[model samples]
Each structure stands twice: as C-alpha cells, then as structure tokens.
Target: MGFFQRFFKKVEEVNNQEAAASELESELYVESPEEEAMNLWVEIAQNILVNSVRATGNSVDRAFVLVEMREQPSFDIFYQKDGDLVMWYELEDPAIKERIENELLPQAPSVASAVNGNFAEIGQPEITFAQLQFEWATKAWFSHIIREDDAHAKLAKDEVLHNWFNNLSTEIKTQQLDSDTKLSWYP
Candidate 1:
C-alpha cells in the first residue's frame, strides 16, 4: 500500500479499536481510573492544539517533550500540536532534559507502540495519573510521527486533527493539566 493509504488504514484501525473498546466498556460497565487518566491527557493535548490552530493557520505537524535548564531542580514536559510556525518548550530543568534524552526518548517509541496496540495495557489498576498522562503524551507524540506522511490524506484528516486538538483541550482542563503550555519556545 502507498504511504498515505497505509496511514489512513492505520488511523481507521485505531478508530475501530477505540470504538470496540468503548463498546466493551459499555457492556462491562467498567470505568478504570487509568483509562480516565489517559482520556484526561488526550483531552488536554487536544485543547492545546485547537487553540494553536485557531491562532495560526497551520496544522500540527509535530508533538514532543522537551527539557530545559535555567531553573534549579525544575523540569517540564509538554505536547506540541498544530499551529503556524511556533516552537514551544516546557520542563525547565536541565537534569530533567538530560534524563529524558538519555532515558525517556529511547523508551518512548516502544511504550507508545504498546499503548497504541493495546490501550488496556496502560489501564492497569496500579497505574498512577501522572504515569498515565506521560504515556498518553508519549503515544500522541509518536502518533504524530507515524501519521506525519498522511496529514494530507483527506480533508477528514484535517477534521480529525481538529477533533484531536479539541479533545486534548478537554483533557487538560478536566485534569487541571500543566506543563508550561507555552506558545513559543527557544532551545
């Protein structure tokens, strides 16, 4: 299959999986805290993207976490969605950035893949809210990379992007999320 075709196929698969899981949830009448947490982050990320898109005419092409230095014992992590040419930074701790670069980034792809493949893996009973948010962010970041080539698949992708951003906003607001939600950043 062509790149765009494969990308759309993957998106459809993901949507189907999510739909099936939701149906199962309704049948089982189960509400997991971890699932709630994951949903929360997704909403937050969506919101950030929506606002950015509204302010600018560009779609979100990349999303990732960053670490910074300039504060003592401080760290930040954030998601970048669609927007006009803008660079934003979160996590202001040098140590945090170093740790993420050395540790988190390497583990991110696998973790994201796993979560995307099976969202339930992350819905562990013991999973903390913080951890869930991190996982969601990681997955979202990776999703951006995998879907990068498919951004223009159809006008529907644009709608999906808008919907994703809006959902992320809801997640952020509902969860009282934070991570230096900045509009511009410098390395």
Candidate 2:
C-alpha cells in the first residue's frame, strides 16, 4: 500500500511538471507588441491592396509589406498584395509620392546603409532604391473614395489609410522601437 501511494504521488508530480512546461512553451510563441503592431498594419495594407488589384481588372503582381527601422526614424510601407510585378499605376497616390520625395529621399542614404549593410556604402545610396523599394511599394492600393473613374465599384471595406494612421498611438510605436529589433509583416 505504501509503495503504491509513493508511485501515485510521483505520477502526479510529473503531470504537474508537464503542464507547466506546456504553458511556458505556449507563451514563447505569442507575438510581441511590435509584431502585433506590424500585423495590424499588414492587415490594413492587404485589404487596400486586394481592392486595388481589382481596379486594374488584372491578375496578381508581386506585392510585399516592408518595415524599415533606424535610430532616428522608421517607416512602414505596404506593397500591393498581388506579387506579379504588373505596372499598377492606376491606384498610385500622388500625395504620398510627393511626401516621399520631400521627406524620405533625402534621408534614405543613411537608412539604406543601415538596412542593406555594406551594399549601401559602395557609393551614394540611391534614393530611388528606397523610393521604389519602400515608399513607392504602396502605390498599388487606391482608396475607394479617392477614385476618379467608374471602373471600380466603391467598396465600404476600404479603410481610409490616413485616418487609420492618425489613430495609431505614437507612444506605443516609440516604445516598440526601443528594442534593437526589426519587424515586417505578411498574411
């Protein structure tokens, strides 16, 4: 009887240990705040991108979402979700293009050097690389309200990106950048 009692106790202890280990493992896979933020932005980008592709009445082109982080400044850019590399200028946002020219192009060299490593140092970093790679990546997505043509149907699902951006908390974003971390996103 005594031996059986000791055996049962040991079994219980082992089960408890296994349960704790499982809990810890699950916690390890949980997304960090930065990852969560990236995901949210990615989702928004995807929604817009899908709608934009429909505007062309064309097939999928190459698409991506890139997050560029540096010490002084950071940027989150969304490429059209379709990854076929089609010429998709129908949805290009001119205001965004202008802002990129004024703000991002000038500081691109430093950012490029940091992100691309030695390749950026070969010569003056091509601001066009940054423009084409990051800022211009999102040109494919057109807002429903902003469209001038009747080709695309107005969908209520399209998020006004500027309004979405305004709603993001700057404090939380700054905190996320504190870690020596880089974050990007996809579905």
Candidate 3:
C-alpha cells in the first residue's frame, strides 16, 4: 500500500473514533423524558410506602403490608394474613395520604364498634392497617353469607387472599424487578 492510502485510512479511523466518543458523551449527559418520569415516580412511591410504614409505628402486624410501585404510577399493597401473603388492594390515586385517609380512616370506627360489641361510634378513632384488615375480612365473610355465595362460602378468607394474590402475582411478575425473589420471599 502507498503512504497516502495508509495516511488517509488512519485519518478516517481517528475521525470515526472522535465522533463516536462525542456521541457517547452527549448520551451520558442527556436523559430521555421517560427515564426522568420513571425516576420521579419511583422516588415518590418509595417515600409514600416508607412513610406509611413509619407512621404505623410498632403496631400488631405492622410490617404486614408491602408496597410495590408499577409502571402506571400505582401502588400495590401486600397484606400478610396468617402467614399467607396477598395483595389487598391497589392505590392508584396520585394523592397518597388523602386516599389513605378517606378510604382507610372511615373503616376504623365501624370496625372498632363491631369488635367492641357495641357497633356504635366511640368518638373519633384512629384506625391502623390491622384494623382495616379486620374490617375487610369480616365484611367479605358476611357478604358471602348474605349473598349465599357458595363459591367462597367455606374458605372466604383463603379465597379472598389467594384470588387477589394470584391476580396481582400474574400482573406483577411480568413487570416487577426481582419478581422471582419477591414470589419466593413473600410466599
């Protein structure tokens, strides 16, 4: 090969390497909108769940709830019932505290009254997640009895817990990071 041909080829290679390095540097500095949104969502969701758990503060079954954030910016809470793990519900609303206050707070009075054998309001009551579970389970059991829903009559608690868990598992398994570890650890 001639000196000119060799020199031209080396020049071309150097130019290509410089262009590639510059492109990589630009990519490193710039973030796509989707990535930014996802990062924000994760931060918000983690804060809510951690804060909620902290708010519970050493109650019975305090750590029973596990919250996971999905792509739709929704939170799924896993309820640990009698050693069986299941997702009790999904919180899709953007205002996490308001949603919890509205939905969970109301049940406290009713559940307390029911358990206390008066079925009457006892002034203002602060309901924890455990009380909420009691309300949910009792309501589910009675609903089945009232409707004579034999499909879930004998094992209402198990049925309710398992059905929701299975459904959530199917959806979450597909999207969740380290889902296999979650399934094994939680189950």
Candidate 4:
C-alpha cells in the first residue's frame, strides 16, 4: 500500500477500536466520585481546545504534554495551508514554551518520515490524567503520545490550567454530556 493508503488505514483502525470500546463502556458505566472528577477535567480540556479554535479559527493538529513540568501543555494547531512554518503555536507564556521544548518534544530521528504533509514521528505522550486526557483527545480526534512517567498523577489537578480554561459550569456540563454521548456507544 502507498503511504497515504496506510495512513488512512491506521486512522480507520483507531476509529473502529474506539467505537468498540465506547460500546463496552456504555454497557458497564457506573457513576462515582472518581468518574465525576474525571469528567470535569475532560470538560476543561475540551473547552481549552474549543475556545482556542473559536478564538483563532484554526484546527489543532496535535497536542503535546510536558512530562517533566506540571505547567500548561502545548498544542500545535494548523495556521496556513501552505507555509514554511505551519505547525508551531506561539504561546504567550514563555515558561510553557521552555517546558515543551525541554520536556515534551521528541528528539527527531535523523530521517523523519513525512506523513499527511507533516512529520508524524514523535514519542509517546505523557499523561497527567489518563481518562480525561485520553477522552479529550479521542473526542477531538487529535492524535496524542504518552511517554512513560512515574510521577504524574492519575487525574491532573493543575489549578493554573484549570483557571485558564475558565469555561462556565453550564457550558462544561453541556459539553460533558455531548462528549459522553459521542464517545459512548449504546445498544
């Protein structure tokens, strides 16, 4: 198969896996405190992406998490369809930028593979909150990478990012329900 064909096949495989898992989750879901907190974080993360896209009119290509630092994670959104530098987002926060370069970005292989007009090779994404982060990524259809980390929390409670997300409770609640419906498969 050609490169594009293989890429599409991989994407289809991922989608099918998600659909099956969602169907299983719907059958087995039981609400608890842990699940509530997890759902909250997922809402906040989604708001961050939705608000960002609304503000800039750009679709996110991928989001990278910084394993070493507990500060804000980084997202690479598409800016120009044809440009030399179309992948980078200029975050106003210098601290976040420094952390991304040092902690999250994967060291490039000598010869990078070009897939979908972008360099698709990167290390696994480190997760602070597995359920929320993964749900957000899956909902957005955004590819993520998780690097192995011993110190990260099961659910990220970064107050700074939470405050930054700052979406209204009603908005988040509605979003949460929408996300759940989309991600959960019901018979």
Between candidates 2 and 4, the one scoring higher on TM-score is 4
lDDT, candidate 4, 1-187, per-residue tens: 3334445555666587844433433333345544443344344445444443334333332222212222333332322222121223464446544544453343212101111012112232233322112222344432222222533343344442343233221233344422533221100
Give me the displacement of residue 157 in model 3, in angstroms: 18
Candidate 3 Cα misplacement greater than 4 A, ranges: 1-28, 58-78, 81-162, 166-180, 184-187
Clash pairs (backbone) in predicted model 3: none
lDDT of model number 1: 0.34
Cα RMSD (Å) per model? 17.4, 20.4, 20.6, 19.3
Clash counts for the predictions, in order: 18, 8, 0, 8
The window of 10 residues in a row where model 3 has the poorest summed lDDT is: 139-148
Per-residue error for 135 in candidate 2, Å, reads 18
Off by over 4 Å in 1: 1-28, 59-187
Compared with the true structure, model 2 gives a TM-score of 0.22
Which one wins on lDDT? 1
After TM-score superposition, the amount by which residue 29's alpha carbon in candidate 3 deviates from its true location, in angstroms, is: 1.6
